[model samples]
Target: MIRKELLSKCKEALTTRQSELIKQVQDHFGMKYEFAKETSGELSNYDNHPADTGTELFEREKDLALNEHAEKELEEINEALHAIEEGTYGICKICGADIPNERLVAVPTTDTCVEHAKNETFNRGRPIEEEVFSPNINPDEVTDEEQVGYDAEDAWQEVSRYGTSETPSDFYGDKEHYNDMFPNSDENVGSVEDLENFLAADIHGKFIGVAPNHDKHEE
Candidate 1:
C-alpha cells in the first residue's frame, strides 16, 4: 500500500516540477523568438537561403528540441498527478505491482516499476552488424595454435594499411616508414605460400607460368 505521507510528497514534487517545466517552455520560446528576430532581420525565412542562416537555423532547431523535451516531461508530470488523485500513483501500469518506495521517490513521474519500465539499452541488445559480420577475434585471447586463418582482426589490418592513428614511436622496434606502424607490418597478405606471391595460372588452368619479378620474390 502507498503511504499517505509519500503520496503527499510526490504530489508536491510533481506540482513544483510542473510549474518549472511550464516556465522553461515559455522561456525557451521567448528566447527563440528574440534570437530569430535579431538574426533574421526580415519578416520571413522564405527570402533567406538555407545555407545563409545556418547558425540561426541550428539554434532554432536546438531550442525546439529542448522545448519538446520539457513539454513531454510536463505531460508525464500531469499524468502522474492525475494518477495520484485516482489513488493509483505508486502501482506499475504493466504488472499492477506496487512500485518500490525508493524507485517512486527517485522518479515520481514514472508509471511502471524498474523491471517493467521501457529500457532501450536492454531491449536493443547487441549491434545488428555482429550477426552477419566476420567473427571478431582478440589476439590476446588466442594462441598461435588456436588462431583462425583470417578473422576480423585480419580484416582491420587490411583496412588499416590505408591509414591509422598509430605513429612510429608507438611501435616497440624501429619503424622508419608510416606503412610499418601497423601490427605485423612485415607479414604477407592474400597468399599462403611464398610461391603463390609470384606464380599464377590462367583462368582456364591450362597455362601455368612464373610471373615477372619472380626472382626478387624468390630472394
Candidate 2:
C-alpha cells in the first residue's frame, strides 16, 4: 500500500512528464510538416546526381524516424498518467512487486522494474525475415563437389573482379600481363570444367600440348 503523500508525489511527477512529452510531440509534428514542405519544394530528376538525391532521402527518413519516436514516447507518458489515476502507477507490470521509488523517479513511464525489463533492452528472438532469406552457407562445411554451383572460390573471384591489393609486380610466377597476375593463372583458373585446366597457347606461336591428368590416370 502506497502512502497518500508518496502517491501524490508520483502523480505530480507523472503529470509534469506527460505535459513535457505533449509539448515534444507537438514540436516533432511541426518539424515533420516543415520538412515535408521543404522536400516537396526541392527538384529531383535524372539530371541531378544520384548521391544528391540519396542524401535528401536519408535526411527525410531521419526526420520521420525522430517524429515517430517522439510520438511513441508521448503515448508511454500518457499511459503512465492513466496508470497513476488507476492507483497502479508504481507497481511493476511483469512481476507483482512495488517498483523502487528511485527507479520510478528516474524513468517515470516504465511499467516494469529493471530486473523484469528484458524488452526494454535486448530483443530476445531472431527476426521473421531470417526464415525467408537464410544466412550464408558456412565456408568450412562446403564440399568439393559444391564448388561448381556456389563456393568460397567463386565468391572470391566475383569480389576480385572489382579489384585487389596485389598487382602484377606482387605475382610469384611469370606474369607477362596484368591479367596473368591473379593466383592460379593456369589450370582451371576461372572455368568449372577439368578440360579447361590445360587449354592454353604460348605467345611464341608454339603448340602448348594438353598434359594428361595424372589423377585420372592413377584412377
Candidate 3:
C-alpha cells in the first residue's frame, strides 16, 4: 500500500507544477496564438519580403507549439490531481497493480506504472509492405526464369549510371563517384567481353583492326 504522506507530497508537487506551467504559458506565449500580421505589428504581410514573412511565421509556429505542449502537460497534471481525489492515485489503470512509491515520487502526473505507461506491451505493429516483400534485394541478382540475360537488372544499371537513390555508403567497397555506386558498374554494357568493345570485325566475320575505347582504354 502507498503511504498517505507520499500521496500528499505528490499532490503538492502536481499543484506546484500546474501553477508554474500556467504562468509560463501566460507570460511566454500569451499572444502567440494571435494572427501573424497582428503579432508582427505590421500593417500588411503583402509589404514584407517572403524570407522575412517566413521567419516570422516560423517563430510564431514555434511559440504556439511550445504553448500547446505546456497546456497538454497541465491537463495531465489536472487528471493526476483528480485521480488522487478519487482515491486511485497509486493504482495502475491498465493492470490494477499498485504503482511503486518511487515512480509516483519521480513523475507525480503519471497514473500508470512504468511498464504500461511506456507502451512496451502495446503492439505498435509493422508496415504492410513486410507481408509481401523480402528484406533483402540484390541489385545485380535476378530470380525470374524467363528474364535470361540483359534483363531488368541491366536496365536498372543503365538508368543508375545517370543517378540512383543508392549512395556510396550503401556499397561495401569504396565508391568515389555517383556513376560508380551501382553494383557490377564496371562490367561491360553492350558487349559480352571487354575486348569485343574495341575489336572490330568485318560483316563477313573476318578479323579487322583494333580501335581503342577512348573513355576506358586510358584506365
Best by TM-score: 2
Give stretches of model 1 more than 4 Å off: 1-7, 20-71, 82-107, 110-121, 127-135, 139-150, 202-219
Error of 3 at 39 (Å): 0.5
Give lDDT tens digits, candidate 1, residues 110-182.
Answer: 9999999987665656688767652445553446436547665667777787889888777898877786679
In candidate 3 the C-alpha lDDT for residue 144 amounts to 58
TM-scores, all candidates, are 0.52, 0.53, 0.51
In model 2, the runs with Cα more than 4 Å from the true position are: 3-9, 27-40, 120-219
lDDT per residue for candidate 3 within 85-124, as digits (tens), equals: 8898899999989999899999888878888896547677
Evaluate all candidate structures by whole-model CA lDDT and list the values in order: 0.78, 0.68, 0.78
Candidate 3 Cα outliers beyond 4 Å, as residue runs: 25-28, 31-33, 118-219
Cα displacement (angstroms), candidate 2, residue 23, comes to 3.2
